[model samples]
Target: MNDIRVSDATQGAAKSAGRKRLLQWLHQIVFVGPATFFFILIVLIPFFLGVYYSFTDWNGISRNINFIGIENYTHILTKDPDFRNAFWFTVRFTVVGILLTNLLGFVLAYVLTKPIRTRNMMRTIFFMPNMIGGLLLGFIWQFIFIRGFAAVGEATGIGLFNLPWLGDRATSFWGIVIVFVWQTAGYLMVIYISSLNNIPKDVLESAEIDGATRMQVIRHIILPLIMPAVTICLFLAISWAFKMFDLNLALTAGGPFKATESVALDIYNEAFTNNRLGLGTAKAVIFFIIVAIITTIQVRATKSREVEM
Candidate 1:
């Protein structure tokens, strides 16, 4: 009887354990199943399809898809001068845009953090541009560049405003740069402001109580403490610069001899406009690889420099 009772108890315990395991699995499926399903259904499947399509001569409409191996990649790499031009243009724009956006953002953040009477108002005014859609903002700035600046130049006799901003290669590049900086800097400024606010007041006080000048405190204490914000801002800036499409579309439309054509826009034109979906997909794959490499490097480098309080 004692042996039988012991065996019954062991079986009961095993049943309980099995029930608990079942419940745990049910919980996970209930919570995580939908998101996983959608991701696999939407993003994962489409991405793999795109990869497969890149090797085939699919014009995005034909019923037939012929596999041509690496011909598309070879053609893009060797013969596509437009792609090369767009790549270089994007590179230059990204570099300049990153620098200006971050610099202006940091400056605005630093100044706005001070106790000024109109600080809140100034912040609102600065950030209002970001709230506008990129397409609308580009159109608004187009008017400003074409008409408003011309008027201002006429009124004030400023040659800078009178130049053909969107009609020339050099001026069009700078015009886009100006609008991009104006649109993006405020968002970065807000991020910087949050970072600036989180810094311990005691540290700044101690630095000040020492013989540290304003610049010294900022350089040593403030800058080091805010490296995380820098990392985030740089990543965002890089992504924005690289993926700039809507503004490029609305503002320049790759005009002035395609001087302002970006890689995104070029890929778009190649795929849809020229009906070379396979080649376009090849370019997109190359672009994706480049962006991934750049962002990874930037994140790692900045992450290494982040200092903990």
Candidate 2:
């Protein structure tokens, strides 16, 4: 009887453990199930479908699609000058945009973090551009470039303002860069400010007492400590600059002999304008791979530099 009672107790405990495990799993499934379902339904399905369609000769409106097996990719690499130019343009824009935005953002953050009477108002003024939609901002700036600048030039006789900003290749390139930096820098400034505020006051005071100059403290202490913020800012800047479309569309629409066309805009024109859906999808796949590789490397490199407080 004693043996039988011990066996029953052990069996009961095992059953209880099994039930608890089952309940935990059920709870997780309940909470995570809907999001997983939607993601698989929406993002995963469309992505796989797009990948499949990329290898075919589908015009995006046809019922029949024939598999072409890398022909589109080959053409994009060798025969397509437009795509090449657009890719080159995107590379240049991304490089310049990243450097300028990050530099300006850090400067703004450094200044605004100081105790100033008008810092809050200045911050709001700087960040207001980001609140406007990209397309809308592009149009607004377009008018400013076309009319506002002309008027100012007439009044002030400034050669810089009199030039055709949206009509020339060099000016259009810089015009896009200016708008991009203006729209994006403030957001990065906010991120940097947060990171700046979190630095321990004692460390800064110690550096000051040790006779460190402002630049020395920033270089040796602040930059290393706030590197995580740098990583986030770089990632955001890279993505924004690389995939810029709406602003490119509304501002210049790849004007001045398609000099400012970005890879994204080229893909759009290929897919819809030229009705080369398969080829466009191929370009998109290539674009996706490049962006993924670049962002991964950037994150890994930056994360390695992050220092503990």
Candidate 3:
């Protein structure tokens, strides 16, 4: 009798849980139908179309497309100098942007969380640039680089005020990095702030009681505890850096030659400007694969480091 009662109770509970899950999923499907549908239409459909077109010679303006298997990929890899330049430039940008933004963000987050009077205000000011639209922000910075800098140089004796921030290759590269770091650091800071807040006071106190110095505490306790945050910020920075287009377009316009054109800008130029939609689609597909591979590697590396905290 006891065994039968226990079995009956377990079965009833399992059935109840299964029904609850089904009902919850059904509710979500009903409520999120519009968003899911729109995402499928807008994002998924275009993505699939782009993938399909990678293997076909679809000129943006034409209806007739030849089924050219691997020509687009071959052209981009073997024949296209422009694609190579853009790919390398994007690689450089991604590396630099990831390092600077994440480091500066971590520093700012650490400092702001300390007992400071104007820390909140400082966080707001730092984060202000991110709220602005990318295109508008790019144009605005372009103005500063072109008009404002020259005017300031004329008034002030500082040569940096007059130097061509966007004209040269090295300066142009750093110019993009500076702009990106300034805009992105605050967002990362916010993430770090949340991570810091979640670290229990007791843990910090324990570190202090153990005679650990500030740097020691940060290096030993805080960093390991916030590995998850580091992982998230690093991933965000890498992806954002790789996909940077609006700023590159508006600020440098890949100027002083095609020196600053990222892969995204290169793809845009190939597809719309030069009417090589198939090649552009190939680049996009390749770009997607690269991002996926990098993200997977990063996530695995970081997941191993994420502690119980």
Candidate 4:
């Protein structure tokens, strides 16, 4: 009788364990399954299809596609002067944009962290430009550059405002830079503020007690503690500057002899305007690889400098 009872107890325990395992599996499927399915459908499938289409000669509207191997890639690397020019222009713009935006953002964040009377109001004012969409902001600045500056020039008799802001190569390049920095710096400033706020007050107090100068404290203490924020800000700045498209379109439209054409804009023109889907996808693949490599290197380099608090 005892053996019979023991067998019945073991069976019950095993059944309970099996039901618990089944419930956990069902819970995971309920929560995670939908996201996984959508990600594969939307992102993964399109990406693989793009990779396959890059080797074929398919116009945007064509149903028939002929495989062309590496011809598009070779043509881009060797013969496409426009793509080359756009690539170089993008490289230069990214470098300048990243540097200026980060520097200005850090400065704004540092100043706002002080015991100022109007710091909150000042932050809101600075960050207001970022709230506007890039396309709208570009249009607003276009008017400012063309009409507003001309009016200011007339009133103030300033040659700087009178110069054709978007009509020339150098001025147009700097024109975009000015607008980009103005729009993005405030966003980065918010990130820096969060990081700066998290820093221990005791550490700063100790540094001050050690007779360290303001600059010295910043260099030796504040910067190291905030390296993670620096890394994040650099990544965001790099991505923004490199992938600049809408603003480039609305502002210059790759105009003034295609001097400010970015890689993203060039890809758009190739696929949609030029009706060469395969070639454009090839360019896109290259652009993705370049951006991935650059951001990876930047992250690794900055992460290495991160100090443990």
Candidate 5:
């Protein structure tokens, strides 16, 4: 009996060791080995290269580089007013875009989730704008703003249709905003619709039984429940607004006189157009830091209010 017990114990130990060895081999084959190699090749290598280049006085074309330390960063922050204005402009656009896009998207989602004949068709149409390339969308809208709208204005003397949408500073800013909101609101509406669908029918029915108005039910029940989607939409809206370049470029081209220059456009011009590679990269790195900070704060703040429902 003692021999039998000893043999069973030995077999159990060996089986456990065999299983661990198989798992270790599987992990190496599946995750640790390829992922580590890919990260070093794709991410780590380029990141270090960018860090090295940001401190140098090398034009992107040259092989030789002179390390100038923080000079690039200093010039970008203090001496570059264009960069400053572009950053501020992006911030303003982002704040307003976040609020309007999410609010409008939520409303659209709420309205469309009810019984309707062409519900799927409407969703596809709404989502179509997002499928279009950003640059192409901007160019299409540019033509509309410049030629189509201008033609309408000339045809009709009414001030509503005749205003110079992209010719003036104030109007141009709003023109860009309008294009952004129109292109983006529909995409966000789909996200809100998914969240809205998850709300329990019983909960809504109880609220209705208590004689809660539609507005009250939405304000009290639906909005609080869909806070997760709100977080996602708000983050996306801010990032899109801040990084808006192609649209600004194709639509207004930062004209009639640099009035619509955004941070991304300014950096692009500085880096590629002006050959100020170091300064542009410095601006880019700083811009990245600012975005990271803003997204972190926004996500954290919104996450605090999110309910399990």
Candidate 6:
């Protein structure tokens, strides 16, 4: 009789445990199911469809698409001077934009973290540009470069603002860079602020007690502690600079002989302007591969430098 009771108890406990596991799984599904479903529907489906269309010769309005294996890729690599120029231009812009944005962001973050009378107001002023949409900001800056700068130059007799800011290749390139850095630096500053705030006060105090100067403390202690923020900032800045399009469109429109055309803009032009969906998709695929590889390498490199708290 005791053996029978023991067997019944064990069975009951196993049933209860199974029910608990089932409930937990249902709870997870209830929370995570909708997001997973939407992501697969929106992002994954479109991506795979784009991949399929990249190998075909499909115009935007075509009902028939013939598969042309690797032709588009070959043409882009060997024969397309515009694409080559755009790629090189994008690379240069990205390098300069990333460095300037990160440096400015870090500097702003460092300064604002100090106890100042108008720190909050200053942060708000700095971050206001980021809140504006890129397209709108581009248009605003366009006017400023054209009319506002001209007015200032006339009044002050300064040659700096009077130059043809967007009409020349050199000025157009640097004009976009200046706008990009100004717009993006503030956003990265917020990330740095959060990271800086999280650093332990005791660690900083200890460094100071050990006779570390302001520069030494920042170089050795503060930087290492906030490296995770650096990783995030680098990733964000790289993505922004590499994929810049709206600002390029509204500001320069690849003008001054297409000197400032980005790969994103090139892809847009190839598809919509030229009505070559297949070629555009091919360019997009190539762009994706390059960006993925570069960002992955950057993330891994930065993560390797992250010091444990």
Query: What residue runs in model 4 are displaced by over 4 Å at the alpha carbon?
Result: 1-14
> Higher TM-score: candidate 4 or 6?
6
Model 4: colliding residue pairs: none
The ten-residue window of minimal lDDT in model 6 covers 48-57
The digit string of per-residue lDDT tens for model 3 on 182-280 reads 889999999999999899999999989989999999899999999999999989998899899988888898876999999999999989998989888
64-122 per-residue lDDT for model 5 (tens digits) = 78899999999887898888888878887788877888888888898789999888898
Superposed by TM-score, candidate 2 places the C-alpha of residue 152 at a distance from the truth, in angstroms, of 1.0
TM-score per prediction, in order, is 0.94, 0.96, 0.90, 0.95, 0.91, 0.96
Q: In model 6, what is the error at residue 31, expressed in angstroms?
A: 1.1
RMSD of 3: 3.6
Candidate 3 least-lDDT 10 residues: 247-256
Misplaced by over 4 Å in model 2 are none
Whichever of 1 and 2 has more TM-score, that candidate is 2
Q: What is candidate 1's CA lDDT for residue 149?
A: 97
Indicate whether candidate 3 or candidate 5 has the larger lDDT.
3
The better-scoring model by TM-score among 2 and 5 is 2
Q: What is candidate 1's lDDT per residue for 21-133, written digit by digit as tens?
A: 99999999999999999999999998888888889899999999999999998998899999999999999999999999999999999999999999999999999999999
Alpha carbon deviation, residue 219, candidate 4 (Å): 1.4
Please rank every candidate by TM-score, starting with the best.
Answer: 6, 2, 4, 1, 5, 3
Candidate 4, residues 1-309, lDDT tens digits: the string is 999999999999999999999999999899999998999999999999898888988997978999999999998999999999999999999999999999999999999999999999999999999999999999999999999999999999999999988999999999999999999999999999999999999999998998999999889999999999999999999999999998899999998999999999999999999999999999999999999999999999999999988
Which residue runs of candidate 3 sit more than 4 Å off their true CA positions? 1-25
For each candidate in the order shown, give its overall lDDT on alpha carbons. Answer: 0.94, 0.96, 0.91, 0.95, 0.87, 0.95
